[model samples]
Target: MLFVNSDKIKSKPLPSLSENTFLRYFSFAALYVAQGIPEGLLWYAIPAWLAMNGKSPAEIGSYVAVVGIPWSLKIINAPIMDRFTYLSMGRRRPWVLFGQLGLILSFLSMSLIADPLNNMSALMILGFIVSFFEVSQDIAVDGMAIDILPVDQQARANGLMWGSKTLGISASVAAGSWIMSHYGYFYAIVSFSLVISVIILVPLLLRERPGEKLLPWTNGEASKAAEKIQLHSWKGIFKSLYKVFFLPVSFIMGVAAFSYSFGRGLIDTVLPVFTVQELGWADTDYSQIFATANLISGILGMIIGGFLIDYFGKVRMISIYMSLLILLACAMSFLKSFWQNDIFVTGFIICFYILLTFTNIAIFASAMQLCWKRISITQFTLYMAISNLGLAAGAALLGPLKDLFNWEYVILCYIVFAVVMLVAIRFINFEKHQKRVEDLEIKHPDINIG
Candidate 1:
């Protein structure tokens, strides 16, 4: 019979969140990397591959739009995660493990599909499944982040998480493009599966803070105690959801989330097609310029932007960044008209990525600040879902817009979205919302309002 020293383990103090910087940062970074790989594959690599394979711009846009639906609908998964968790296995770790396993299996399945292009419908279904797992994993990760990190450290954690995600995308895009060019789609899928398998180890090894419940496999007593503590109830869950969605500051923040990226979505959908077709660039070339360079710039932006948000405050930093983005969009349009030089185009793209990355990091950090500890996963995911919805809406419309309007007109639309986003930001009162969250935490001291 297998035996373990439960007394010794129980006597030991669990590692505190701030006690180990490497463990904390590395864990968050690795999970974010796992999340980013599939995104890079579906959002960046596959679109280029499909375009190269003779898929029309409309088809590519539609494919992305359809697959992206899961991300925008992640709010549905968020509430479930918030209400239920395997406390013994770790509140969020179990979901992370499940999602990672799903990702591996989904990729493996894709590798087995002999002809994805010929079976476009099947490919899209697989894509949707992959996104479902990805977004589910994201929900768990965000919840864990809120629980573990102290208020002072959240911004830095957000930076590391986003930077790691961007780096993962860069690696995936570069590797996927090269592999697809050299070998085939099957090999690319195999490579992704292997990378994800490695990332799964991070969450598996993680342990919840000491004194928390453990799964039955770890310790029976702790699990039983965890079961007795009721954090989930239908009425309470709905009440929390209602407050998060309807509260003034939170409602405005949600609007900002939906508006902030609306323009970028339009630009992102068309840019890949334009680069490959009009610019006469190969898949690898576009990947290197757009994916690799943008990701590198984005990593820097996240780090810098995170610090700026923490220092200068979210509202101020976001305003500055968004204003710059508006100007950059107009400048990009002008450059397209007059300066067709490759060097200038590449430079502009890099600059645009830097500003975009900074803006996104700021916005996300702002969202994190708005989350209520009791239902952080649901609240944060709701904001993120709205952001994704806006992006997806823009992407879905890009194909139709392109067919009807010229490129210049599309750029103008981007500017219009930016202006609207700026207006929405004015409605959000970060300080007021933060005070309310504090008040809630004070009232519910028993809840782990991290």
Candidate 2:
């Protein structure tokens, strides 16, 4: 929905990412790609593979539920990240490096399991660990991006970052599935871990801000910008967060995002199980098809999604996207006979994913727009956590719902979520929030409140 590059931050003697547009985008995109690898493996590949191996929906749901919990709970990390950092090394870089290393270590640890199907509990614990690290890395990267990127570059950077992540997920899912099939899980985990290991080079190689340490041992001092803005206590952050987030528009946007994500989460959980069990596609085939769909969606998203969102307006595009989602759900629910046609189901999956990619861009744009920028990191993280919480709820509910209802009934629930999203956003008054924040900015002209 937005791109991020800095024209304001001038190039230094040695240079930093904030000063180098090409390196800036590359580093951000590459880090997100690293973010997607474990996500593809832990969230999509492992669960789908489990379904292929004859795991029940309830069991699979449990795994996703446990793993996804950490992401939703990551709101706490935001305040901590805001309050404490090694400013000499850049505000967020230390956390990014820490989280990236944790991701690699956690990915490697997944290989230690001898028999995954039998060791479901261990799988859940390790999955939880991996997700925990991933979210930490995610928050740090996003915060750094928010600080580094100028408004002009946000739309393009957003598309590229999203596309890179999608491509990474697609590639990892395809390769991970194949490797697990022939070479086994150990090699699959190791290979992806190795790929993620390559991402660490980015942070080590490029600085976030000029004069910031590339490593802890290097000589550098905290930038005046960092020192001036650094919070002396949590009280100020929490106070500002309360004032901004409780505003009517901000609250509604959070609700809208959650409801929207809930529907998406349901679809994600249902697809792998439904395609393999009912549609009769092999696990590897389903994985490959899913990967292919994501591959296409990623490309489309990067090429066109951002430009359209900026041109069309965020709220209008969001409503349109949600309507299509409702219609798609209706089609899937009512047309039972259509499921018999392999071409139809395949087409449905591809179309749904493509639409999802576009819709997400719009939603992201809205979230970015709603942010107060006073405590923007914490505020944005809160919105994201709410969305993730909704996703977790949807995933957790699937197994129970499947036990009680027909497949059609389950898909039709998407209508409820879509409707809920529409209603929530209808109450959002963006200008109202913007006006209030403007008042705050007037009070503190010296600060960049936005």
For each candidate, give its TM-score against the true structure.
Answer: 0.80, 0.80
Locate the minimum summed-lDDT window of 10 residues in model 2: 441-450
Question: Which residue segments of model 2 deviate by more than 4 Å?
Answer: 1-14, 44-69, 108-128, 180-187, 269-289, 330-339, 393-413, 423-432, 441-450
By TM-score, the best candidate is 1
Clashes in model 2: which pairs?
2-154, 2-155, 2-158, 3-153, 3-154, 3-155, 3-156, 3-157, 4-153
lDDT of 2 at 88: 95
What does candidate 1's lDDT look like per residue over 1-450, in tens digits? 388877656555446333566788788889899998999899888888988899989888988987888876776788788778767676676788889899999988878877887777878889888888998888888887876676666777788888898888878877998898789999998999999999887776556454443434665223343343325665566666676667788888887777776777877887777777777777667656776566676678656757877888777877887888888778877666554577877776777778778778777777777777667788788787788888888888788887888776766678788887788787778678878767665675544322
lDDT of 2 by residue, 283-366 (tens): 878877887888898888888877776676666767787788888889999999999888888888999898888888777666
Q: In terms of TM-score, how similar is model 2 to the real structure?
A: 0.80
